[model samples]
Target: MTTTPAATPPGWYPAPDGSGTSWWWDGGQWVQPPQVPAAANPTTLARLALATQILLVAGGAVAATTIAVEGYGVGVASDYLNGNDTSIALFDLYDQGTLVGSIAAIVATIATAVLWAVWQFHAAKHVAGQTRRTPGWHAGSWFIPIVCWWFPYQNISDLWRAIGRVRPTWQIAWWVLWLAGSAVSQLSSRVYLAAEDLEQLRISMWLSIVGELLTLAAVPLACLIVRGITQGIVQRAATPAHTLVA
Candidate 1:
C-alpha cells in the first residue's frame, strides 16, 4: 500500500486567479491573506486625484451658471415668440456662456474621467493582495457599460474594506448621488433636445439644475474617499503584517 502525501502547511501562495497577489492557504482551506506592502507608492496619484476633483468642481460651477443663463433665455424665447421685443445683446451673452461653459465642462469631465481611472488603477495596487478583484477592475469597471453603475462603487468599497475598515456613509452617499445625478442629467439632455416649446425647455433646465447640484454635493465626498483611502494605504504600508489587526 502507498502512503498518503503529507498535508501542506499553512502559508501564503500565489493567488489562484493569477492576479499577481498572494492568498493564505490554511491547512484545509483558503483564508484571508496578510497585507502585502504595495510596490509603488500611491501618494502621487492621490495628489492628482485632488487636483482633478477641484477641476471638476470648478467645471460644475461653470455648467450651473450656464444653465441659469440658458433658463433666462427661455423667457427671452417666450417673449420673442409672443411678438415682444427681446434684448438681442442679452441673448447673445447667454449663447456665449452656454457654448463656452459647456465646452469647458466637457473638457474637464473628460480629463477627470481619464485621470480618475489612472488613479484607481494605481491605488488598487495597495490592496491587490487583500481584495478578490483584480487590480485592473478598479479602472476598467468605470468604463464598462451598464455595470459601470455598480461595479465602480463595489470596487471602491472593496478597496476600502481591504484596508480593514467598514464602509463609510460618505461612500454610500457619494455613489447614490453620483448615480442619481447622472440619470437626471441624461434625462435633462434628452428633454432639452426634444423640447418644442419654452415650457418644456424650462422643465429640462430645472432637471439639469437639480442634477448639477447633486453632483456638486458629491464632489467633496469623493475627495474625502480619495484622501481616506490614500492615507489608509500609507498607513498600511508602514504597519507590519503581524501587527495588523485584520
Candidate 2:
C-alpha cells in the first residue's frame, strides 16, 4: 500500500522547480507561489517600508482633517437653514480639505508603490540569501494575473521564517482591516464623487472616515512587522553559524 505525502508544515518550503526562491506552506498547499527577482539590500527594503509608513500616517491625518472640515460644514448648513445671517461659506472648508487631501493622497500612492517593491525584493533576497532572485520577477509579480495575491503572501511568510521571526496574531487582523479599508475607500470615493447634494457627500465622507480608521489601525502593525523582520535578519547575520548550530 502507498501513502500520500503528509500535509506540508506551516513554514517556508523549497520551490518545486528548484528555484532558490521558496513558497510558504500555510498548513496546507492550496496553490503554487511564483518567484521574485534580484533586489536591493534587505535594509534598504526595510527603510523603504518605514518611509511609506510615515507617508501613510500623514495621509491618515490629512484624511481625518477633511472629515473634521466636512463635519463643521454640516453645522454651518444647519445654522443657515435656521434663518441666521449666513456668515460663513462652507465651500471654503471643503476647498481647503480638497487641496491638502489631494497632495497627501498623491504622496501616499507613491509611497505605497515603493513599499510594495521593497517588500517583494526583500522577500526574494531573504529566500535566496547570498544568491538572491532575479530583479525582474520580484518587481513584476504583483501585476501578474491570479498570481499576485499568492506570490506576495508566500514571500512575506517565507521572509518571516527565513529570519526566524514569528507571525503575530495582529498580522492577520491587519490584513483583514487593510483589505476592508481599501474596498470601502474605493466604494466611498465613488459615492462621494457621484453625490449631487451635500447630504450625500457628507454620508460618503463618513464612510471614508471609517475606512481610513481601519487602514490606520493596520499601518502600525505593518510597520512593526517590517522592523521585526529587519532586526531579526541583522541579528542572524551577526551571530556565527557555529553558535546557531550549537
lDDT of candidates 1 onward, in order: 0.73, 0.62
Once model 1 is optimally superposed onto the true structure by TM-score, how far is the C-alpha of residue 204 displaced, in angstroms? 1.7
Off by over 4 Å in 1: 1-38, 74-89, 240-246
Q: Give candidate 2 misplaced runs (Cα > 4 Å).
A: 1-46, 73-88, 129-151, 242-246
Cα error of candidate 1 at position 246, Å: 25
lDDT of 1: 0.73
Q: Candidate 1 residues 74-153, lDDT tens each?
A: 66766765777655456687668668867877887788788788777778876777776788888888989998989899
For model 2, residues 1-246, the per-residue Cα lDDT tens digits are 112145646655564446565544445342344332334234566666567667666666765665576566556655655665553576677668767776777677666756666665665565565323343466666667766655655555656777776666677776787778878888888988899976676677677777767777776777676677677765664342321100
240, model 2: CA deviation in Å?
Answer: 1.0
The best candidate in terms of TM-score:
1
* Model 2 weakest 10-residue run by lDDT: 237-246
